[model samples]
Target: MKALVYNAPYDVSIENVPDARIEQPNDALVQITTTNICGSDLHMYEGRTAVERGKILGHENMGIVEETGPGVTRVQPGDRVSVPFNIACGTCRNCLSGWTAFCLRVNPVEGMDGAAYGYANMGPYDGGQAELLRVPHADVNLLELPPGTEHESDFTMLSDIFPTGWHGTELAGQQAGDSVAVFGAGPVGLMAAHSAMLRGASRVFVVDKEADRLALAESIGATPVDFTQGDPVEQILEATGGRGADCGVEAVGYQAHDQSGQEHPELVLDNLVKAVRTTGGIGVVGVYVPEDPEAADEGARHGRVAFDYGTFFTKGQRMGTGQCPVLRYNRGLRDLVIAGRARPSFLVSHELGLDEAPDAYRHFDKRDEGWTKVLLHPGQ
Candidate 1:
């Protein structure tokens, strides 16, 4: 099988690797149809994380089940399914309590509770950016898709960003008629804005400098705030009548920067603290690590940011931070797509084959024009 393998910093290529097979009794082998190259993957591709060489690197996946183990009862051969990024054991305490991202039985490394395919320090499971993928705990992990090829692009999002975007709103406690200000306009940020609209937010503000991404935000009825024009926090506040947004989301991870491309690890968090209303909730769906030896900030080398704890304390703001529990919302979001209510595929700007992944990574990492979202078809 040909899979996308990570070689070193700023490098990845398609290579003929060993075939993926069912290794567990509850596992299912899938013929992958669509696998995404996530912004998170750039972290590993750029050597920011501890991700080793020679590992397959994709997690956002959906495909048709080719075969299933004897222990798998619900999911079977020939069923189309979406695999969540998290590789969780269904019987764990965290999984039972709806926190599948923190499942205790997945990652074997000490002190790490959660696990994901092809992620840094997550687990040993390989990813689906190839012709085949082995899904563990198939009965509980795979979300069945309807028959036919309808909504293939949209349904593909159910594996991660759609639910993750919805999870950002869930963390911020967004409600109908309330105002939301989402920091950043990347895929996840755009999805967060879309999720805000889905939940009936009276006003949704997306902050970014990119014309293409902000245009996509506006296409979904969100007001675009161009940080390059002026102070993004002030723009959000002014748009909210100076009271600030009722809730806010941090979609840019620790790699956040300004117009001049200077890396500021704490920039988005501080901006969110100022953009959101006092006592209003804030959700952080962006990636933040415990260590970044390559970070530009001297204080952030140990993964500690210069957060605005003083104002956060005085404002009494509520905060929720972590990875999305993809299983919790995939079903409902899938129905929305089936009903023609949500179209996450709108954010997709490019769909290329697996061979083009390395170039796509370079363009996306540089935030090149018109490269908003990309979907890699392994079998193409």
Candidate 2:
């Protein structure tokens, strides 16, 4: 099996690795068909996260199950399934409460309540960016696709970004006819804007400096705000008659920056605080780490951002932040796809074989033009 292995900062290679096998009684072995290179994966690829060398690095995955353990009764061999990025046990306290992202029984390390495949500080499970992947707790973790589901490229997004994007709007308390301002126009941000449109947002504004990404957002009916030209908050306010958007979503996370390429960890948060209307809700779906060794400053390295708490409190705004519970929203979103109501594959800019993953990583990490998203076909 050929897998994308992390070597060091700004380096990854496709190497022949041993095929994954069923290691647990509840496990299933999946022959991967479509896997994605996520923006979150770029954190590891850029050496911002503490991911070690030689580890496989993909989590957004969907494939055909080839074998299942005796305990797996619901899903069988030959079923097409989408694997959530989070690895959770079906019977944990958190799982029972619909918070699968914080499952207590999956991570082997003490004090760590959550786990994910191929993620640093998550667990020992390898990712699905190869010919074979080992899926633990298969029945609970895998979502079987509807029979004859032909949109593999679109269905593949249910594993992570689709649900994550929906979760962002949910966090922001977006309602029908409400206006939403979203920061960042990456895959997740684009999905967030699409979700807002699906949920009936009257107006959606996507802020980003990249021209290609902003164009993609516009194609999806979102108003594009190029921060390179002017202040994003001012643009949103000007468009909204100076009252600000009803809600705002910070999808750029801690790596946020200005048009000049200067890293400002709290830029989005401050922008959201001011861009959202008073007493409105704000959702943060972007990744913000407690420790970023490669941060631009010592304060950011320690996860300290000079946020505008005073303004946030005075505005009476509420916020929701953390990783998305993929399982909670995947089923409903899948149905929307099956009904042809949503097509996330529009964000995919490149589809390459497993051997081309190394180059794809480089281009995506740099946010190169026309490289909005990359999907890898391992079995190709």
Candidate 3:
């Protein structure tokens, strides 16, 4: 099977790997049709996480069930499904309560916080960036696509980014008629802004220094703010009549802002504090973590970065940050996609075969022009 393997920092390639077969009675073997090179994959690609070499690297996946274990009842062979990024056991206490990402029974070998396919924080599961994937707890984790949908590219994103965007909006308590500001104009950030609009935000301001991304944001009905030009906070405040926005979402993660114009997760927090009105809330969906000693910015011991707690405290604002619990919201989001209310596929700028994954990763990781989102069709 051809799979995308992490060779080293800034090095990924499509190599022939061993075939994936069902290893457990609850497992399902899926012939992966589509997958995406996610922002989270960049964490491992950049050597920011402890993702081991030779691991397949992709999480957002959708495909057809080639075979299923005897215990699998929810889906059978020939059924199309979109697997959530988080692998969960539906019968677990956490999963029963709708917290699938925190499932207690999923990653027994890695402790808690298990993930599917290829992922850094995820366990030893092989990702779907290959020709096929073995899905543990298949009955619990796979989402079957509806009968009439044809845009596989769009449905593939529902496996991760769309639901994640919805999670960010839900975390921020997005409501109709409220004005909102979202930092970062990347795929997730743009999706967050789009989600805000779908939830009825009166105004959605998307901030980023990239001209292409800002333009994409505008195409989706958001007011674009380029951080390189001037103070985004002032622009947001002025746009909102000096009271700031009703809510703000930080989507840049650790690739935030700093004095040197480098990666700083704290800048998003500062912008959220300054751009959000008093008592407003903020949702952060960007990836943030300690720097790797060997790859980039290795000096820091603590995962600590700069932040303006005083401003946040003074504004009396509420904030939420973490990984999106996709299982909790994917069902509802699926309905939205089925109803044509959310077109998250709009964020996808390129679609290529799994063989093109190395180049895709390079371009997307470098934040290259027109590389908003790249979906990989594994069998292509």
| Per-candidate clash tally | 0, 0, 2
Better structure of 2 and 3 per lDDT: 2
Q: What is the lDDT of residue 209 in candidate 2?
A: 90
In TM-score terms, candidate 1 sits at: 0.99
Listed in order, each prediction's TM-score against the native is: 0.99, 0.98, 0.95
Q: Flag regions of model 3 displaced more than 4 Å.
A: 108-112, 147-149, 257-260, 290-300
Tell me which of candidates 1 and 3 scores higher on TM-score: 1
Worst 10 residues of 2 by lDDT: 144-153
Q: How would you order the candidates by TM-score, starting with the best?
A: 1, 2, 3
Off by over 4 Å in 2: 147-149
Q: Order the candidates by lDDT, highest first.
A: 2, 1, 3
Compared with the true structure, the alpha-carbon lDDT of candidate 2 equals 0.93
